[model samples]
Target chain A: MAKGYLNFVLHAHLPYVRHPESELYMEERWLFEAITETYIPLIKYFQKLVDEQIPFRITMNISAPLITMLTDDILQERSLKYLVERLWLAHKEIRRTKGHNDLNNLAKFYYYRFVEQYKIFKREYNCNLITAFKKFQDMGYLEIIACPATHGFLPLINITPNVSRAQIANGIKVYEEAFGRKPNGMWLSECAYIPELEDALNEFGIKYIFLETHGITNANPTPIYGTLAPIISPKGIVAFGRDLESSEQVWSSITGYPGHPNYREFYKDIGYEADWEYIKPFVAKSGHRVDTGLKYHRITGKTDFKDYYHPDWAKEIAEEQADHFMHSRINQINNSASKMVIPPIITSQYDAELYGHWWFEGPYWIYMLFKKIHYNQDTFELITPSEYLSKYPNIQVSEPAISTWGAHGYSEVWINPGNDYMYRHLHAAAERMVYLARCITKPTEIERKALNQCARELLLAQSSDWPFIVTMNTMVEYAHKRLKDHIGRFNALADMIDKHDINEEYLEDISYKDKIFPNIDYSIYAK
Target chain B: MQLLKSEYYELPAKYNQTVIRLLVQSPTRMFVYWEVSDETIKEFNKNNQNYSDCTAVLRVTNLTKNYSYNIPVSPFANNYYIDVEDSGCNYQVELGRISKKKFVNIYTSNIATVPSDHPASYDLSKDGVLFGNYLCIGNKKRLKIYGNKEQYSRFQNQNHTAFENRRNGSSENNFLGSSDNFIGSSGNSMCF
Candidate 1:
């Protein structure tokens, strides 16, 4: 019998960054990059695992906004075009670096990667990632979970209880419409949880939720298993806490596997290293420097000086790291197995983007890990949250405490003094949004359209990424503009409704710009 | 609960809205913004034909704790934004007219929670940051990673600056323009 279970969860989320007016918006590149790097690599690995008949279970949160972007026609077309351009660039790189031994090989590697992912995007899923994930769900290898609409930090958005309620409701609605079934679990925005959020989760029929470890261990009645077992809320919502030990083992930069000198360096890219004139057309439209993801160097001892990347060396390290990770988990499960009434479950999760985006070898590491575990592991079984719950129905009842997975383990990173200034605007807009949603009982077609547009603006405005960017001090200007623009749109739409002169031109302009939640009903917020 | 309408006010069709809102700025500050449309303002002026003392009364209620406070708004201020000092309470704002010391309630905003800086907003948490350390909060307790000694020492050498930054409390501690703690050189595991 397996001594313990290992549950791997990947949260795939990106703030809705669709700009219909301008093609090639800098922010929109986030989606395309994640698709080419993270999403495609992950899917390919999972597909190989399935082909090999390696029984595995993983819970993935395809966040509402990311799903919206993935399914977006314009974005799909843009992603394909983006991939072709990169492939074209890679072909050029191959010819330009023909004489140089290291650069030529690296160029070929990138070319094949881009080609494979683009083929997967077009040939396999028909340019719809939702279909691919749903197929996996239907096949019982993966559980596709919904992330809250717009990835709002629920603890703060719950201030207007109805806003959180609407978010939860809308998220599931989108997931169900896309996947043809309700989600089994949800990845909370920032893993920030307040006690009242469980009621919303339970009300929406979300069976379980994953939180930062403290979210479970800090439960009212302390859980016996700590982060090893799931805690049940009074309302029957199951809460899975992250295994801190396991998480740190993989995520700690100093000791993490990705930091191995052989791995590809995330910061060093051709976009910055290459001749600006040569890389201009391939970089962002502004002709400014941006990561083209064509990294030619390894981490190489953490210096400004870099060494030419060795693919064979990186592949060797990836396999070793994967083996090392599996052994670490086995050791952990064995260590905890003796004390638990039921077999322990070690749950580990990370940002899906971290795999192929920041840590380029991450997907390769994951593939090797799964492959190593499939034939060799006998001590642990990979299981999904739903699978674990099914096997162990009875759980310790406790209400989780308020917590987030931020640096200080609270809302300070997001709600600190620097970003606190916008809470008032967000909250006020949310309140007025609920009022607008509730008040419009009888409406003309235009009135309904305007109301729906207002709700869209509210949802877009509530995204936690804006505040996060401000606090993180990256793209602060863009973040501020996004927050202000969304709220500004919401308030302006409200004014139009008040004046009883719905500006068709203005409404159409905004409607075209913020094209998310196509079938949203304003009544979702009417409590 | 009926609103008093004046003859001069041309209220929009189905014009029943009192743009009153409450936003939690921090653990201690609640920001309020409310606006009365032109039609409503015109109606209010027309109703006060004699122009007796007409003041806007802002009444705030903390529904979570069942506490309430009534603050007077400046009559001339059509657009008002005020900051109330409080936290950890679910609040609602009501705008009313005060004439001859009799209040007539006009608009009530939706309830919004004044977010607490005290992250211990849980029944299970006895005090401090968490619910009793069952799920365990805080990144302070990092388990010693069992890895190759060679890799560990190499990593330690590279991260010496991070440790130095932490000791000095310079860029890492500063929230302003400090991407050091957020992006590069920091290993804060994103808990999203």
Candidate 2:
């Protein structure tokens, strides 16, 4: 009867860059910008849906490190200050550029919106972003999934079984602390699916997880339907494969709705256009240039003069795009559902930052998409991963092929020659830390401090950021420094322990400096 | 009981160099501090006895030339305080409490050599600035120096040029006297 069930999953994450000592650091803006543009906006959309009785269903993966940062007092205060500054700047821009009707109007709109959002963020939630998302999860309007601690690229790091287990176990602990409940589903970083990865997920009681399209189609049992529905892993965990056709429409640069001529062009930003003197204060002194989040032109045309964007017009376009995407998904599910006896489930997963950071009208489009699906009962029904898995309990068990949701659908993006060098040291550190953890019996306070410092070092080194940074060649120094510093610290601690020496004060200082997991046990590395 | 023994060596008055040998008898990494000039120190090597050789030497003599290297210390390092006094042509140093198992080096050329008249009980503020009851070198030069309560208050207000001239022509000893005069309302001491 219905076109089939459509499950939308958004994975939200950013590397932790809280420098409490530094008043103004460039990398810290990553969280601030995401909070202002993506997280808060998505929360508002979901809250509105609940208030309007929209009955919309969405699954979101909020990584453990992100959750920690969201709940951190220093980060929360800085984010609020950042939002207030941006709002003030927007107001000033509106007044300064009063002659440009569209720009001025849009500026005013954003200024007021930021002010209202800041008030709601600070006053209502007491400046806590996690609580806002938890409210939606608790209300049953959204299903919040957890990711591995620090969003570690598990398949690559799973070189050892213990590393994988630690990632999963630590993730569950942090997720429970932030969300007040255990997660039912997990989002593997980059949708990197390995056969044994699911065992760890199942061990932690995760009922389902998402994967790339090929992970289902190329299943060992050979999925007959080919990513048209969810597949159950041998561990009894459900694997929802991303729908390729639907993904192409949203992710492809040439054909994606985000590339529509009316939408804002992401490349044209005030960072380059505005006077250097005026923008210098905002730009970091580190000699690296990053997006300043203020753009003045729309995509306009393939090769034409710039046309200013109007937020009102952009909202209208977003609605149209939402309608278009919904119809496309319906057609996709209808064609597949015709072949299967049961209603096929279409899983659409995307990076959450893409909504607001890349597509200015992304959150609006998502809101409208859910609205269209809710109204058109015959075409599609919005469902969470847990909801879908429970309804369709029977599924084919198989091991997914080695695949990732990256450019080539392979490991080249993360593990090529350019980045493989770091992997050797990373693996060595991981193995050595585990060895040390296991050999030590009844870890004293000093041993615990050293072990935790070693864990922090290994985890920071294990960050997908280092490899991605090397591949992109942006911030390669920073990524390299981070990896080396952590590895060096880990090695230093290991060397000390090997010689039967424990310097508690030095260990404690490093433990505090690189503190990420407070309750982390050194024994996790050992096992 | 496993005891970790560390050795601290005091520099000769005429050597203008200090070397501290830290021995970790229990076979562990040890963080040691030197109560000398704020010059940078480098670990030369570790012997079979697990003793590490750290060497510290003066790099610069004048206060004005040394002010530029006083950037805010990275939060990762352990910090220690030292007193600098102008001995007319050179500087005399008094070491403060050596931080335990913490490694932080102060570049003598970057900090104003401790003034000869620096007071007792240098109060290390919460912000990591050493504020003495009298004139004291801050994390930075002249502008950050706290001679008295009033000057410290003014420094907190970010009056950058407040103590600039005193940093240049006046030696560390004259700098202390200048602060005293300014604090005692002796004359309209130029802010810079």
Candidate 3:
């Protein structure tokens, strides 16, 4: 019998970045890269675990925007097209590195990997990745959760009760529409929580939410079990705080498993190393160099000069690190379980893309980690938050402190001086939207479509990605443009509604452009 | 085909409403931004011709502690970060002016509550089910950093100082975006 439980939660998300107007937008590649590197690899491994009849339980929250993009006809075709291009690039690499044994083996590895991904994407899943995930959920191997409609930072945008309500309700609506059932858990936007969020969670039937470490430690009256067990809020919503020790073991990029010298270097891609003309077709259409997902070097100890990657050595290290991670958890679980009446649950949560997208060997690390947990030890077993709640329904009740997983564990990352200008526009738009939702009773078909699109624009404009990107200083221009564009569209639609003269052509144009929530009812704001 | 002529990149400078908004930036700092419409400014100037001598100030009242302080801000500035001394307190702010000697209130903000940064003093369990000892490795040192008054204040303010350091080219950690330090993948090193 297991003495403790380990809940692994992965929040997979990306801002909606579809552009039908032109392919020159380099930002669209964000989706393609993530699909090939993160989502497909995850699906591949999950499918393998099921085939081997390995007992494992994992929870994942695929955000609403990502679900919309995954199911869209345009982006689906683009994902397949993107994989085909990578396949061709791998073919070229195989020919280019025929003589060098180390480079040739790595090239062949990529070639087969892309081929398998293409087959799984095109034939096995029929270009719809959500179906693959849904199959896993139905098989009892995975628990899929919901996220905010646009990945908005809830605390910053919670100016009025209705604003956060609309974001959460629409998020649930999207999850239900995609999965054919209500989600039992929700990955709070950035794991940010305020006390008022409980009403919305209970209304939407969300049973649990994960928080940062301090959210549990600093709770009112102090949680008796600390972050070792889930705390129940007054409203009956279960809140699980992340365990710092386990988080540091896997998430610390400097000391974590991803930084091992044998792992493939995420930075040393062939897009910039290749002859400009040779790699031009694989990169952005504007002729700018970008990551082509063909990195060949290893992260060889903080130096500019990197050595050719050895996949065999990387696999051995992933297994070794898996052993290290498992043993560390076994000890942590045993030390705490002896002192408690009930088995303590250590919640380890991370961004799903970090595995394969950022750390090329991350997905395999997860695969090996699960296998070790199954075969190597009985000290702790993998469990989802929902499963744990089912087994142990009674929990300590406490109100979590306001918190987020960002720097210094608060809203400074989203509301700092660098991006404080957007909140005014966002709040004004939400106020106008609530008023419109209340005032507009009966409407024509065109007016109804326009109202729904207006809601979509407001949600998109409020995404935390823009502020986060601006603060990160990586894609400032694109982030600024996206924020401005969404706000601009929202105002234009509001004016059309106010004038009582809707532009059919203009409405059709933006309806196609920012069409995220197809089933979005404007009355969600009224609730 | 180009859809809807290039999007207007600039937002309206003002929404034509005189309003003040307060947001909690951290446990120790609260951000307040307000806009006084031109019409409201004209109305204020009409009432007091000594508008030039008036300084725009935010009168922050800690509703929980029953104390108030004033932060003088430039009339032209749109926002200011107000520092709070205590966490877990309810604060209400008013955007007004100090003309000559009297305080004239323009608009009052919604009550903003700063979050607590330390563990509570009491546990409700009668049997004294204390779980603090098992919280982390080096539990005493970690609790000292989180529960100690002066140390907790410095730790909370370190995030802002870190940002300032990065802006001044003194630190390598991008704070929120460095993949080497931050757990999140907001870094630009691998972003396309």
Candidate 4:
């Protein structure tokens, strides 16, 4: 008998970065890179498990922003263009590295990877990855959850009245529009949580949510079984806490599988490493260098002089690590179950992009991990939260502490001195949005359009991505610009609404530009 | 109309409203950002005879415990990060001027609730064991407990080498900076 269960939750999210005004903004590549490296690779592996008839149940949260981008015709077309360009670069690398055996082989590997993923993107899935995820959910192998519209950090945004409610309502709306049914679970933005958030989750019929380890361990009345058992909040929503050991094993770059020497180093991309003029065409439209996703070297230790990547070695290590992971879980469950009355459940949640984007061999690690668990061990079964709840419906009632999966496990990462200036603007805009929604009981078509756009702008501004990027110090310029753009557009819309002079032209342009949540009702903020 | 230029997106300096907003950052810390409109500042100085002797201060009151402290701040800074001693306490801050140790109210903020830093010492745990065919949740509703017993038979263990020894290499070389902690290392996508 399986002693315990392992719930692997992968949260896939990217801030909506679509610019119809510019052909290829450097920032747009964030989505394109995620699609190419993370989403497609994950889809291919999921398809593999299905074809082989491996009985696996995995939980995935595809954020509303990612879904909107994936389904948009422009992004789909742009993704194809991005893929074809990488293919072109890979093709060129094949000829360029002809004399060298290791570089040549790695180049060919990337060429085939791009080729296969391209076909899967174009032919199999028809350019919409959401459909692929939906099909998996229908097959009962995956449980896809919803996220806040635009991936706003709920804890801080909740300060503005009804903002969190609107975020939740619109998040579910986007989920239903994409997945054909309401979501059973929600991956809280950044796994951030507060007790009051349960009211919103319960209202939205979200049966369960995932929180950080301390959020559970530090709950009121104190969780008896610690993070091993899912606790039901006072409001009846179940909460799953991340298992620290499992998280550290996979997420710690210093000790995790991604930091292994054999894997392809994420940093050493060919775009910057190659001769400038030769790789310029594959770079950004602004002629600035960007990651072309064609890396030729392995991590090869902490040194700058990297060894040529060996895929065979990385694959062998991934399988070995999978075996190690399975055994570790078996040992952990064996040790924990002996002490506890109920079987312990270890929940491991990670950002889905880490798999293939940041950690080059991550998706393969997951693939191998699942395969090993299926054929090799019986200590723990892979279970989703809903499935676990179905088996063990009655849960301990406790209120979770306020928490997030950020540095120091709090709001410091999102609301520090670096990005604190934006909150006043966000709060003011949200208050105005609520006011507008309440006062404008009846409105013309353009007025309604402007109001709905107002809500969208506020939601986009509340995204945790902007402040996070500002604090992280990578791509600070783009983050500043996005926050400024959203807040600015929102104020302009509010001004036009107040003056009773709805500038149809301005509204039309922004409506098309920040066109997310097409069916958003401005009335969500009215309450 | 052409698209709004990037410069148009610059956020305004302040809304013309006398308001104080307090946000809970963590158990031990709270953030206070307020905008006192020019008129409100003028009105305060005009009304007060000892305006020159007044000091701008953030008077943070812990509503749950009934205690308060004054944090001296620069009025021109417009915002301050206030550290609190208590977790799981309701706190409110008033941004005002203090003259001769007397606080003159300007704008009181909405109550900010700092979540509990530690679990409640009061144990409310009940037996987690499945006692019957159905389990009741706090007299709310009864749910049938299926008790997942479907288990795979024990299989032969495969002999696989542990990969930890292979991780002897230092992570000094990289584009994305390396971190010793898991949350610190999560990539640009904000995994944590």
Candidate 5:
């Protein structure tokens, strides 16, 4: 029998960013980049593990917006175009760096990676990642979960009970449509929770949720097992607190294993390194260089100079890090088991993009870690939250302190000054959504489409990424425009509903653009 | 959609007199955002209610179990620091006008529970429009130096020193965002 359990959850979320109007919407690259660099790599990795008949259980949140993007034909085709351009660029790079052995190897790495991603994207999965993830779930190797309609920061947008309720309700609709089953758990956007959120989760029949460390440590009465045990709320929904030690080991960019000098440097791509004229065709229309995922340098040290990255060295380190991580977890679980009456379960969750997108070696680390834990461990077993909860259902009943994995461990990241002004607008829009949801006394088919589209607008605007991006100010104009445009659309639709003016042409235009949840009911927002 | 347990979300008292709503901001704070409507203000005016005499009396009632409270606010505070001891206890709040020392129910909020920490911890919740500018890896600074010069300059000019402060682990006025805070941000207020 296993002495303890370790639960790994990867949250895969990207804000809904689709531009049916533009052929080269620059910001849409976030989705394209993630698809090529993050999502496909993970699918390929998991496919290998499954083919070998390895038994593994992990939870993933296939957030609503990501599902919509993965299923859209335009994005699918655009991503394929993006991949083809990458392939052309990689082939050119093979000759460009023919003499430089290290750079040539790096170029070849990207070339084959793109080639394989193209195959997996087009043939294996047929360009729909959601279906692939759904297949994994159907096969019982993966536990797919849900998230808010557009990953709205619930504590802020949930001003009205109905507003939050609608976010949850619509999210469920999209999840069931994509995954073919009701979600048993969900990723609270930003992991931001208020004390009363359990109320909403229970109402939605969600069984479990997670919080950052303080969320568990700060429990009314300090938890006996700290983050090692899940806390069931006074309501039945379970709350898993993130393991700080494990989260920190992987989260630190400068000090984490990914920053080791042997690992490929995340920033040193060939796009910027090569001659401007030579790479112009591969560059954006604006002549700005984009990351080609063809980095040749290693994160040597604090200095500006870097070394040529050795994939052989990086894989060795990844293997060592995987073993190191598994042993540390084994030790932690064993230590906790010796003192605790029940088996201690440590939950390690991270943004799924971190694996292959940012770290590059992250997928290898995960692949190796699963192997090391399976073959090299007797103290701890890899488990899912559902498995742990069922094995030990009688848990301490208390309110897991309200928290999020965001900046300040609270709602400040979403409600701060730079972004706070948006709230009054957001809150009012939510109020209007609830009002229109209930007030549309009777509606024809056209009016009903307008109302449902209005619900989509409000839900899309409420995505936490917009405020997060606004606060980050990385793509300020884009984030700002997305929030305003959605609010503008919602307001226009609400006004039409109030004035009894239904414009089918306008409705069809937005429906074609912000087309996510077609069958969603506006009545979900009814208070 | 199957009806949510009517009791789970059903409002306790139908509040129509005032546009008053309560939010449990944190563990120890349950505050209401209220705008006494024209009718409410007019009614108060007709009844000879003065600003000094109108106190926002918050009433907390346990909807699930049997428990309640009537706490008086000091004349003009929209925020209430609640002391309801039960964690995850189901409760609702109502704000009223204490006219001539008599409690007058003006508005009530949807069912909510007190947060898990003192509301004072949220002093920084509105500290500033904190721009969180860091992700787990490949920040703008490196992106800039690595020769994505165009986008780098654009992102650099757009963000502030807060992101820099965050990465340095300074915990300065930046109020927190990513990297160090991603792993953990130590605070004196949490239960630990």
Candidate 6:
């Protein structure tokens, strides 16, 4: 009469934006903020769990590109410098608010937290964050999964099957290289899936992958047990569908538990409130306010008078939210299990960065939820996808329906009218590269180099970020440039080969420039 | 291998009376052939450098083959492989050993190396190349391509400026800003 297991997966990803040419690009703040708010705090929580001898199991998907940025010495050094500056700014704010007891107390708390976290980041973790997650993974408290090389969208780019295959293969290679072992499951970029994609996943030796809610519910055979159970695809890979009810409670900005009146308001940062002249040191050159990680007020409420944020109160709210969420999940598992002939799994997936970063109390909530689940052993337990798959190997097989956790159930958000032009170019580039690869026989050294360069360009251009950027308009220009630069290089190389005036020096120069997929074969295009 | 004239290479309706000439070259001699096909030879044209038309041009240098036929090109039969016997520096020409249908197609063109005698070119200053420089194949004799010294120093300066801008919460016209407009768009537009 063991209770059903709850498999929780958190996906962590950010686009690569290490601006060696600019010391203060606003986009770079994404990584720093994630590091400060999400990564460092999660590590501390995991370490505490280990210290207390708690047997908590969690699954995480860390994208390869983020790992590359984390492991980079230059980025690490820059991040450390950035954190130190934040610490100093926090210290100043603590001193400035000395007369106001509540404000002063909150400022002091954040200042000390920054100082303590930075110490852990520098000394305990050596500013290399992956090792912390790896340590928990090694200790059996967590299972770490790999994601796409650059979080590239697989379904749309499956035009040349090899492009998608290479992304999967290369992703696994780099993931294993970083995490010290091969991953059991992979988080498909945006939970995007197509029937043909399963064949590629199976070919790459991936045993399990996750999908959105409808990907399973609306599946071809229409999963009889619903999202509460895992389905084995025709290709023998396990597919875990996300639970919508559980995800909504955490992902929704207005209704989510993080929006509790007691939690800190994510928007009311010190960067915008502090005096302009005094905060000039922290503002970017464009004068647009940016997140400085030092905030003063708790959410209070939608209409209530503002109250100074107290960490202790925030912790209480977190515990309450965790208890509520745990009870909801336990009820969900029980309700689902009773209806099924076998023990069901309730898979709750979320972005790892959501914890501690967007939702300040997220990691704590996770910690408390695990404790509550363990305490109530009769109703629920935490489990990883691998653990569940190993135990329930005889699950039903089905083909997941086409869907993504985007605007529509389809790829409209990532590939609609706003971004169609980018796709047109991408498709053209892919077709052309494939055509070029087929035409060459005994490629000269120059031809081989140019062809490889062309493949790299095509792959980079196909990255889902360019389209997302176009839709979001966050860094539309940068995304546009990336796509153009890569495609232009691809076309130019084609022109060089067509004219029989192959420029090896030029090819080598461009190859060194867009150095993604270093081992990618230009011959992939030839065929 | 047998060299049969493909029936899809028929002449267009507008050029029904046109007579196409064949030019086949080998080290020792050249052979010319003439023919007509009932079907049209409408080659499936892809802008890829590795397309059959481009590959045919490159392969012709060794053992060339040409057919003067009135048949329109079939979109599917766009590529053909030639077989040749190497006789010292010379080669014995053979035609149509491989067809597009039988061969796996490769669409990207091969990369050629920059010859030493070519114009002075910009060498990559960093171990990895940025996306901007991907379009720049060396040997631009007219434009002053930044050398390793200039490129590396400029990169360092830009990196410092970017870092400073981030530290101060500012967005300067550093490399990231300069390249912003071209980031998410498509088509043949260039970023500064």
Q: Which 10-residue window of candidate 5 chain A scores lowest in summed lDDT?
A: A390-399
Q: List, residue by residue over A196-282, the lDDT tens digit for candidate 4.
A: 686677678787899999989987646767899887654566789999988888899689878889988888887887899899989
Tell the DockQ for candidate 3: 0.18
- Which tens-of-lDDT digit does each residue in A1-527 have in candidate 1? 88899899888999898876665468888998999889999899989999999887888998889988999998998888888889998999999999999999999999998889888999999899889988888999998899888999887667674889878888888888899998878888988777778667767877778888877766654665789988765445678999998798778988987788998988888888789889998888866788887999999995889998988899999998888889999999888887665678888989899898888889888888888877878999889987877675545545676668887667766766567666667777777877877788888999999999998888898898998999999889778888877887888888899788999878887887788888888888777
Relative to the true structure, how large is the alpha-carbon lDDT of every model? Answer: 0.75, 0.65, 0.83, 0.82, 0.73, 0.65
lDDT of 5 by residue, A1-527 (tens): 99998899999999998877765556778888888878888888788888877777888998999999999998999888889999998898898889999889978987998899999999988889998899888988789889988999988767674878878888888999998888988898988877656656767768789888888877643555678888654444578999988888899865677787888788888778888888777756556888766678888878799999888999999999998899889889877787665689889999999888888889888888887787887888888887776676545444568777877566656655577556656766788788877877577888888888998888888889988997887888778778888887887778887888877667777777788987888887775
Global lDDT of model 3: 0.83
Over A202-253, each residue of candidate 3 has an lDDT whose tens digit, in order, gives 7777878999999999986477678998876544567899999989987897
Q: Scoring each candidate complex against the real one, what DockQ results? A: 0.03, 0.01, 0.18, 0.18, 0.04, 0.01
Off by over 4 Å in 4: B1-7, B42-47, B50-53, B99-101, B123-192
- Candidate 1 stretches with Cα past 4 Å from truth are B1-192
* lDDT of residue A518 for candidate 6: 52
Model 5 per-residue lDDT tens digits across residues B1-192 = 112111111111222335655554444444455545557767776775774557667778877677777887765553444655664456778777777777677777767655444222322222211112112112122100111123223434755221232223334222222212211122311100
Residue A354's lDDT within candidate 6 is 88
Candidate 6 per-residue C-alpha lDDT over A146-221 given as tens digits, one digit per residue, 9 for 90 to 100: 8777787876666553667766776787788778998889999888876667656766667778988877876544
Which tens-of-lDDT digit does each residue in B25-98 have in candidate 3? 89999998898887888888988745656898899999999999888899888888999999989999999999
| Model 5 pairs whose backbones collide | A417-B128, A417-B129, A418-B129, B26-B115, B27-B115, B27-B116, B27-B117
Please tell me which predicted candidate would have the highest lDDT against the true structure: 3
Docking class of 6: incorrect
4 or 5, greater by lDDT: 4
Q: Which 10-residue span in candidate 6 chain A carries the lowest summed lDDT?
A: A390-399
**Candidate 5 segments whose C-alpha is farther than 4 A from its true place:** A285-287, B1-114, B117-192
CA lDDT, candidate 5, residue A482: 83
Provide the TM-score of chain B versus the true chain B for each model in turn.
Answer: 0.47, 0.16, 0.61, 0.59, 0.42, 0.15
Worst 10 residues of 2 chain A by lDDT: A392-401
Q: Provide the interface RMSD of candidate 1 in angstroms, 1 decimal place.
A: 18.2
Instruction: After superposing candidate 2 on the true structure, give the runs of residues whose Cα lies further than 4 Å from its correct spot.
Output: A1-3, A285-290, B1-192
